[model samples]
Target: MENCSCKECVSACLNDPGRLVPDDILKLSQFLGISIDDLKENYLVRVPVTSNGHTAYALAPAKKKGQRYIANPGTVAPDYYAEEKGRCIFIDDRDMCSVHEAKPFECGAYMGCRNTFLGKPYRAKTVEEYFYKRWKSK
Candidate 1:
């Protein structure tokens, strides 16, 4: 927790670091109205099944496609679907999230894009505020 600011960490972790370090999957399970274990099993361990080959970190493989994006053989999921999946942990691109609020578990665990502020690198003050700042452009 070195160099950790209270508000920023709280914002990043999405719970009171005072009460407890929030279990991200647990929080997601609660929000999705599903069992924690089920959520973890279904989302965390399961990789997206993509036919374009693979993105390295994607939970599932990309579905097959007709030739729009050749890097992978399949059609890339639209931004909307990608966003819904959250952090797009399939590759090295951490900056491209189609969804933030409802992103998938892998996206949630992504620490690469944290601490960005107003186009500057800094700790986000809170999750709510961070989303407001990050996604307001869309």
Candidate 2:
């Protein structure tokens, strides 16, 4: 079987690099030869999940003009969901991921227009739990 070069997938991810899971964060840090703490401080942002009051740590989206692509709609009753839009910081001028080997789970699973299986739906709590643990450790 021929290997899938992931050219299409990478193209789609270049447009919208989706949220990162906790494990992705750790892996990304290691791939970038940095500490988890440094990765979080430098490249991650706390996004509120509306389904729960907890905040999930996600890769910081790239900025354009004076606006951030990630938009937090603020806390709403019952759920405090925020929305992330835009390309990942790791995506370079060539429309490729700088940390493709350590790309987040969402990025890895995305199949672009091919519509392949992209894994199970994300559980915000898992990310929130990771955030709390990391927060406590600090």
Candidate 3:
């Protein structure tokens, strides 16, 4: 179980899209076989961003066997930025996610390339619903 102070846990949870609840923190601490304090100090890296797109919290997909974790270009038209104001986090010069290490677990589980937010096991309010609406539209 998490034996750390709320301050420590909150510091650790910042910018983490996983949004680990207290129970999850406890489970993770138990799984890591370390004190929650240590986990918070050593492993957690916070990177808070202004919430933007549906895929903001999406996990990076797993690489194919022996391949690297490269992000693919989204199906946006060339005039996407001209038409829309927001920026995409996935569009690196090399087509890789900058925050690949901190990506959510859902991205790691995705198999369908065309699918936006792949949520089947659990229901999240934002990205999950976004995917549902997108899929329904198609």
Model 3 Cα RMSD, 1 decimal: 15.5
What's the lDDT of the predicted structure labeled candidate 1? 0.33
lDDT of 1 by residue, 40-80 (tens): 44433322222233222222223212322212322333434
Weakest lDDT window of 10 consecutive positions for candidate 3: 57-66
Question: Model 3: per-residue lDDT, tens digit, 8-83?
Answer: 2222222122322223434555665778666555444221112234232211111211232112222222322222
- Lowest lDDT 10-mer window, candidate 2? 72-81
Off-target runs (Cα >4 Å) in candidate 3 are 1-23, 49-125, 128-138
Overall lDDT per candidate, in order of appearance: 0.33, 0.51, 0.33
How do the predictions measure up, each by TM-score? 0.25, 0.57, 0.30
Backbone Cα, N, C clashes tallied per candidate: 20, 4, 1
lDDT of 2: 0.51
Leading candidate by TM-score: 2
By TM-score: ranked, best first: 2, 3, 1
Q: For candidate 2, give the lDDT of residue 83.
A: 34
Better of 1 and 2 by TM-score: 2
Please, what are the lDDT tens digits per residue for candidate 2 over residues 29-137?
7899988777766666554332245443344433221244343222121222233235566776776668867656655554554645344344555544544554432
What lDDT score goes with residue 35 in model 1? 86
- Comparing candidate 2 with candidate 3, which one achieves the higher TM-score? 2
